[model samples]
Target: METIAFFNLKGGVGKTTSAVNIAWHAANEGIPTLLWDLDPQGAASWLLDSKAKSKAQPKKILNGKTPIGNLVKPTNYQHLDIIPADFSIRDLEQQLQLQSEQGQRNLIAKLIEPFSENYALIILDCPPSFSLLSEQIFDTADALYLPLIPTHLSLRTFEQTRDFFKKNKLKPKRLHAFFTMVDRRRSLHRLMLAHPPKMLKNGLPTPIPYAAVVERMGDHQAPLPAFDRNAHVSKAYASLWQDIKATLSDF
Candidate 1:
């Protein structure tokens, strides 16, 4: 499977929403998708209509007694499986760190190999941090999608991601940079988009518009298509999925 991680060091960038929606689109195309919720907040799980239990302990994906094959739960939507996030996943970074010291740096890769050929795509909803887990995601992902906002801090975070990769000396792969919740009316937003930050020149061709409909998905517990597929925001999301599929070359 093509393992893709949706990540942003900065939060509230619609990372989870994009992961879930894209997974849906991929499944709609007759490809089975596995959505792994790695965020401690469990927003992706919630969005998938899975109850995220904060107190429940999560199976150790790195070195747990039970293999991950049993953790897979079928989603309400066909061809979409989910690895629900429990708050205990917060400890994954620690476990990964220990595993790293023991010469197993590809903890995630090894943990993921079993399912690599089982699904067409694996969507990882990462936490908003540059922690050990995040590093693992960056290192192992076939593609990394960053949801950037039109703001100075967001740009800074994007720079940090690049610098981190540089420090690690990783060969570049499919890295996507796209603007999210973009407001065209705002002068700052327009300026950022018109000028086109250097990071984005080689990235996505479209910017996701700032639309209330997109935000309403959280409260409504549904994807944009469920509410109104022809809505402006829905169209933007569908188009974004199309572009991502082309970039990934497998959806």
Candidate 2:
């Protein structure tokens, strides 16, 4: 299975929203998809209306104490399942630190290996941090989708991610990025959309507009396309999924 992670060092950049939408779209396309909530906050889990039992934590699976498949919970959507996150993930770094260098690097890959036979795509909703957990994600994900705002600060974070990969001699199969919370009326947003950073490998041409619908995800507890498929935000996410599908030809 191909694993894709929605990650960013800076929080509040629409990472969880993007992940939920993309995973929903993937499942709508008949792909057996699993959305794995890796963030300690469990925002993605709540968004999909899925919950993990108190005893179900990623730490056990990573440490080889629990079977990955057994921890998965089916979501409300068809062809889509989820492995919800729990607060125990806050100590994930400490757990990884206790392992050997090889184990630290390969822990995530090993956890997901057994699920390859069941899922065609696995989407990871990651937390906002640059730590051992991020390193594990970098090693595990086939494609890294970075949700960035059209601002200088966001570009700086993107550069930091690239430098981290370069410094660590890591190369993910694909790196996709796109602007989120865009306002067409704003000059800066217009400028960034007109001329995106040349350094980025690929970017979705459509930008997810700043809309109340997108912000109301917590209240809706469902993906944008699930309730309001006609909304502009939903259309933007659709375009993004199409672009991503074309780029990830193997999908």
Note the Cα lDDT for every prediction shown: 0.80, 0.85
Task: Give the TM-scores of the predictions, in the order they appear.
Answer: 0.92, 0.94
lDDT of 2 by residue, 16-110 (tens): 99999999999999999999898988999999998887667566666788887878999999999998886376566667777745544566777
Could you give me the TM-score of model 2 versus the true structure? 0.94
Q: Candidate 1: misplaced stretches above 4 Å?
A: 52-61
Q: Which tens-of-lDDT digit does each residue in 1-251 have in candidate 1? A: 78989999898998998898888877877788999898878888878788644443454444666677666777778898888885376467778888889887577777777897689888899998888788888888888989898899898988888878878986345568888899998999999988988766556767888887777778867667766788877777788888887777554
Error of 2 at 164 (Å): 0.9
Regions of model 2 farther than 4 Å from truth: 55-59, 101-105
